[model samples]
Target chain A: MQVAKTVKDINNWVRHTKESGRSIGLVPTMGFLHEGHLSLVEAAKAENDLVVMSIFVNPAQFGPNEDFERYPRDFERDSQLAEKAGVDMIFAPSAEEMYPRESPITMGAGTLANVLCGKSRPGHFDGVLKVVTKLFHLVQPDSAYFGQKDAQQLAIVESLVQDFNFPLRICRVDTVREQDGLAKSSRNVYLSETERAEAPKLYQALQQGAAAAREGKDPVPEMARLIQSETSGTIDYIELLSYPDLNEAPDGQAILALAVQFQKARLIDNIIFTLKEN
Target chain B: MQVAKTVKDINNWVRHTKESGRSIGLVPTMGFLHEGHLSLVEAAKAENDLVVMSIFVNPAQFGPNEDFERYPRDFERDSQLAEKAGVDMIFAPSAEEMYPRESPITMGAGTLANVLCGKSRPGHFDGVLKVVTKLFHLVQPDSAYFGQKDAQQLAIVESLVQDFNFPLRICRVDTVREQDGLAKSSRNVYLSETERAEAPKLYQALQQGAAAAREGKDPVPEMARLIQSETSGTIDYIELLSYPDLNEAPDGQAILALAVQFQKARLIDNIIFTLKEN
Candidate 1:
């Protein structure tokens, strides 16, 4: 697999690919590649003529008090994993390379970014949208992939793509999880032995809520209560938000979202499934 | 010479052209087409295989107290002129078509937009950026053409394109002028016969500023005084901003921008030139 370390190289490859009329697929990640990232690559490889996987730990997305200094990084491991997953090219740009200067223009999410992770991490979605826009421009991909683990992110990005009239199609792959129920995340490495034991509970709690909702139960309050009862850490919010929009779903057709401050690291996860009637 | 009043039809045409690998050029105008707009269309036609000229008298760009109700539009005349200018298509979306739903995304100009036209007309640049962004998405053009008559607009759009990575090449055409040296603008109609005779004074003041700067004079304060002395209306601001970034030029490569208000209408214009060793 070819490895592109700069925006110029990626654009060169993209130009050649587009001239050949091949559809390029992109999967953006923060670089501690896991089974979840692999799933996105697999999806890209299946549907596209060329698959590009980018690894950049974006600084704009992390707050000043956040764990930006020690988020995570292992380029050798990430490149190897991406190659193994049939990625055509690996774009691994440094933080400086990814963002050369301060972004003067910020993409506004409006109401879409006012809840869930947006509430806990202010200016986070703006950062996310900024980096993603840069990536999309550099790659000029026909399609881009993201995991549903970041349910709100998926929704916001989809909205950005649509609202901006971006020419690419966005695909949301299912959230890849561990053998147990916990969702895969690079930040999962931040959990301590004791906190790691409790990490699964976060996803487990989401599962309980998802199950209750899927069984046609009005589980917004129920899910909130169950998550609050099971988790001893500082809970930011444990509410059921409508799929995609993040509004309070009265009929419970919403995703169960969770965030808890375990010791020092802030952990978040969600489960999305619609309520169905017999 | 076909006129498409609907955005959908224009989209269909533009999409077909894109799918067929034809490069597109866009010239967005607030109708009342004159030599200035057609000059932009001419530039687009020279550059791309397909040109889509959109005539939209955008309401959002005008403040409530401003002349949005009478901002000057003549779609039939515009389409005829655009066709003669060799434009392949014209997108004449109504206010309803351009903003069917209320726009959630709004743009801000930070410090640059806080002076001159933006200072007198609040939210003007924001509306300009927002509608321009929407036009960029819908047209998906390889290049966009804008006249340098609106020097601040040209500069801000350059920054916007760079920040958003919109894959657009902004081609700035030279300012087109009437026989009297007055810069061509749709709002030039709002001037009375006396005000119209004095319209050339705006350009004359700019010429004076450019000449003085070229002769090693600090043109900022002098140009402001010149513009104010020449116009008999309420002078809003007569400031000099640098090219590209629109900041104050340290070495006299400044743009002379002015805004003057009569009884019913407020008018704005600008000119840019470089300083030299005398």
Candidate 2:
């Protein structure tokens, strides 16, 4: 696979690829590729003529006290994993290259972002939208792959594409999880031995919450109590909201999402499913 | 020329145009075609294989008390003029069609929007950015044309393209003016006969202000005085700032801009020129 480190280089590849009448698929990520990221690549590769994986630990998406400086990054290993996963190109741009100056245009995630992960980590999704905007412009992908693990992010991005009418399709890949039901994340490395054992409970809680919602019961309090009683981690939030829209009423589809703060890592998990009408 | 009233129609045209390997140029306008808009079309035609003119009044850009309801539109006339001006297609979508639902994503025009027009009309440039984002995605033009008559808009747009790395060029078209130096504007129709006669003084004041700046003199007070003495209209604002950035103290290029409120219309004009070092 070809590895490009600069915007000019990737743009050149994109132009050449487009001139050849090949469709491109983008899988945007923050390096230290795990099974989850590779799964997105696999999905992208299946449907597209070319698959481009952007591995940039975007500083814009990180808050001041957030783990931006310590974000896991291993380009050599990432490149190897990307190549093995059948990616056509790997775009690894420096922070300086991606953000040359303060952007005059800022994106705001409206009500959809005022809940769930967006509540505790304010302005985080706004930064995601900004960087994603930059990536979309840079890659000009025919389709982009996103995991359902970041369910809220997927929803916001879907809204962005729908509202702005971006000329691309968003492919929703199923969340890649470990045999123990723990969602695969690069931050999983930060979890202690006991915390690692506790991480799987986060997903289990989401599944139980989804089950509760399926049975026509409010899931937030039960889910919160389960996690509080079972894990050492602090509950950041536990929400059951309308899918994609994140509104209170779950009309057709809904998401049961939660965040738990361990000693070092903040683990997030969610289950998105259709709701049955009573 | 083909006239598209829906997003799907325009997208189909865009897809076909792209398949033929031809470059598209977009000239976004609020209809009521004049020589100024036609000038933008001419510029687009010279540089691109196909020119798509979007005649959207963009309700998003107008404040509640502003002239949105009274914003003049004549699509039949506009299409005819656009055809004569060598436009390939006209994408004229309705407000409802363009905005089917409230957008979850919002754009903020940073410091660049806070000074002149943005000062009086809150959230104006943000709205402009939103619609322009939609148009840019819809048309996917190789180069988009903007008249420098709306200098602040042009600057903010340029910043948008640069900051977001949009895969297009922004062609700056010189402001088209009448023989008497009045900038051609659709709003010019709102001016009373006496106000129409006095409108050219706005451009005159900008020219005088630019001349003062060229000679290293502060130009706002002098230009304000000149317009006050010569015109019966009230001066809304008169200021000189660095071009495009709109920051205080011009280093290389500067803009002397002003807005005049007439009996019914608010007229604006500016002169953007390179500043000679003192």
Candidate 3:
């Protein structure tokens, strides 16, 4: 498998692939390979002639006080796992290489960013959009793969592609999960034994919320109540809003999402479903 | 030459061209076919296998009080002129087609946009960046052409491409001028008989400023005084700043730019040059 550590290297690979009439699928990620990231790569490989997985822990996407300093990175492990997962190439650029200078063009996430994760972490989606814009230009992939685990990010990215008319497709892969129903996440490592035990209940609460919504009932309060009773972690938020758009409409496709803040980690989970007709 | 009035049509042409391993050069313009725009077309034709010209009077780029409603457009004339100029295709979509819904992503021009024309016209560069982003995505050209006549816009665009690492080159085309040295612009039609005669002085003042800067002398005041003494139009602004970055530096390459608001039209002009070593 090819490993590209600079923009020029990745672009060279992209150009050669395009010249040979091969379609590329990009799976953009921060390093520390896990089941969730591997799932995206698997999805990308199935749909494209070449699968490129970008493994940069983007500094732009983290808040000043956020976990940017401690964000896990294991390049050797990641490369081995990516190669094993059938990734054709890995783009792992350094922070200096990725951001040579401050960008004069800044992208705003608009109203879609003012809720949920956006409310707690301002400028987070903007940073995500910025990096994604650069990656899209650098890779010029035929299609980009995004996991449903970061549903808000996926929605915002989809909006960017639609609004800007980027010449690519967005493929949404389902979230990888543990057998006990906890959403698979790199942050799952930060959970204590007690916190880990309680984490599964977060997803369980979301499942209960989904069932309630399926039965034509409002699910936010019920979901919150379940988490409050079961988990030791503090509830960050629990919301049931229109899927993708994230607006206050529950009749159509909706997402029942919640975030729980533990001693060392903040974990989030959601279930997207179409509400049954009343 | 093919004339595409829809995004899908343009994408089809782009995809077909890419499949055949042909490079595309884009010359984005707001129609009324002036000599300046034709010059960009000439530049694009010389560099790429296919030249795609986009004639879009982008509403996003215009202020509410600006000349959006009255922006000059002659599609029949433009199509004929473009065909004559050897344009391979023209992508001219309607405003509704370009902006189907309010975009959830907004682009900001950053510090580069807070001076010169940006000061007088807020959000103008933001709008330019927005439309340009969409165009760049739609065309996906190998190189995009821009006239140095809109020096600020060119600088901002160059910054965008550099900072974002867009996989394209920006070919700078020299400004097309009248026999009397006035910059050729579609807005030239709005000038009255006497104002038309006085217009060439704008370029003359810029030439004087360039000459002064070449001699290591301050040029802004001198350039402003020359315009004030010579032209009947109101002096909007006259300044000398670093080329491209548009910051207050005069040592390296610099630009002496000015704007004059005539009775019915606002005309702008500039000259870019490298300062001689002291």
Give each candidate's interface RMSD in Å.
Answer: 2.2, 0.8, 0.9
User: Candidate 1 lDDT, tens digit per residue, B30-139?
Assistant: 88999999899889988899888888888888888878887787777877788888888888888877776764444677776866676777788888887898888778
* Full-model lDDT, candidate 2: 0.91
Docking level of model 3: high
C-alpha lDDT of all candidate models, in order: 0.80, 0.91, 0.91
Please give, for residues A106-145, the per-residue lDDT of candidate 1 as tens digits: 5666787788888878888878888888898888888999
Worst 10 residues of 3 chain A by lDDT: A218-227
Q: How displaced is residue B201 in candidate 2, in Å?
A: 1.5
Q: In candidate 2, what are the lDDT values of residues A1-278, reduced to their tens digit?
A: 99899989988999889888899999999989999999999899889999999999998889999999999988989999999999999988998899999987799998878999999888999999999999999999999999998999999999999999999999899999999999999999999998888778888888888888888989888888888888899999888889888999887898888889999999988998887888
DockQ by candidate, in order:
0.50, 0.88, 0.88
**Higher-lDDT candidate of 1 and 2:** 2
Per-candidate TM-score against the hidden true structure: 0.93, 0.99, 0.98
Candidate 1, CAPRI quality class derived from DockQ: medium
Ranking by DockQ: 3, 2, 1
Span of 10 residues, lowest total lDDT, candidate 1 chain A: A245-254
Stretches of candidate 2 above 4 Å error?
A: none
